[model samples]
Target: MTRAFLLAATACLISQAAFAHAFLDRASPAVGSEVAGSPPALDLTYTEPVEPLFSTIQVTDASGGRVDQGTPKPLDGGHVLSVALKPLLPGVYTVEWHVTSVDTHKTEGHFTFTVKR
Candidate 1:
């Protein structure tokens, strides 16, 4: 009985750990999407609440020029990060982000979107 209880507890802990990390749930422009016009801002949504003070995002043009206005700001209780953008011309933009979840887990990723003429 003790062994069975220990196994159940171990499984529960492992399952919880699997979801403890903050992962990118979705984003505006929808990762690798192409838009007809420039979006006013880039919005990133995560699976867990993140700490804005410990997060960063960068949007760069195809030529590798930074296009994001500045640092990111949190929204929806830190489940989302919004980054303002400069007026973007027709081109591909890369967004790179690194965020720390409220649980203190760090996650980072990058995606690209294109603006059609």
Candidate 2:
């Protein structure tokens, strides 16, 4: 009986940990979207609070040139990360992000958005 209880408790803990990592919940310019003009900054919302100091957010133009300025700031109770962006021309931009949750789990992803002329 003790062995069964231990196994069940371990499985529950493992399953909970699997979902504790932060994920991209939303973005200011949004994923795979087109905007009429340039946005001054990029805001990324995560599923959970993240550690800003250990997180990275990079924005690049079509030519793979970095366009993001300054460091990523954690806001909205650490559930959102924002970074300033340089003046963007009418083109596609890629956003790549890596974040570590307060729980110490790491997650990363990339998306693209376009600016229309």
Candidate 3:
């Protein structure tokens, strides 16, 4: 029974390790951070390399109009995704992102940031 339990545990660990998802590791303006001024771009670093083609990032203001410009640009060897932003005025902004890791697993997340007056 002890030998069988150990074998099962090993299998479980290996199976979990075989799958990967690109989870947000960090950000430029950071999650829920307050900034003094507008950031030219939003930078998101993930736990694994993500595919640019399958990724989408949306930045919007409290009024719900999009502020982000263009497609996501892969940086830091695809682990970091950056998107340009239009000139922003001081207010609360939301960032919504979806990414597909090289393993083809899809992950998504959203956060908010404040630009101080």
Candidate 4:
């Protein structure tokens, strides 16, 4: 009975690990970066495979308003999430993202960046 209980617990743990969603490993323009030129795009690298259909990235201006003109696209087989930015005035911007892994687990995170005139 004890052996069976141990096996069940181990199975549960393994299942949880397998269903874990990906997380941001790094972001291009590095969070809170200040740049003089307009960033062509925003890049977000994840810790694991992400589902493109359920993953999204948004950039908001310093006033807490969404400035991204369009939707984000997947890069490198859905490992990176990116979006283009319009001409932004010098200010701080926030990047908010929500990603769902192929395994069906979901994760969300946010970061900030700055643009200099």
Question: Evaluated with lDDT, which candidate comes out highest?
Answer: 2
Scored against the true structure, residue 43 in model 4 reaches a CA lDDT of 88
How would you encode candidate 1's per-residue C-alpha lDDT over 1-117 as one tens digit per residue?
A: 999999999999999998998999999989999999989999999999999999999999999999999789899988999999999999999999999999999999999999999
lDDT of 3 by residue, 11-66 (tens): 99997875578899999999999999989999999998999999999999999999
Candidate with top TM-score is 1
**How does candidate 3 score on lDDT?**
0.95
Candidate 2 per-residue lDDT, tens place, 11-117, comes to 99998987899999999999999999999999999999999999999999999999999999989999999999999999999999999999999999999999999
Residue 54, candidate 3: alpha-carbon lDDT = 98
TM-scores for all predictions: 0.94, 0.89, 0.89, 0.80
Ranking by lDDT: 2, 3, 1, 4
Off by over 4 Å in 2: 1-11
**lDDT (10s digit) by residue, model 4, range 51-111:** 8888888898877787776777888888888888888888888999999988888999998
Query: Of the pair 1 and 3, which is ahead by TM-score?
Result: 1
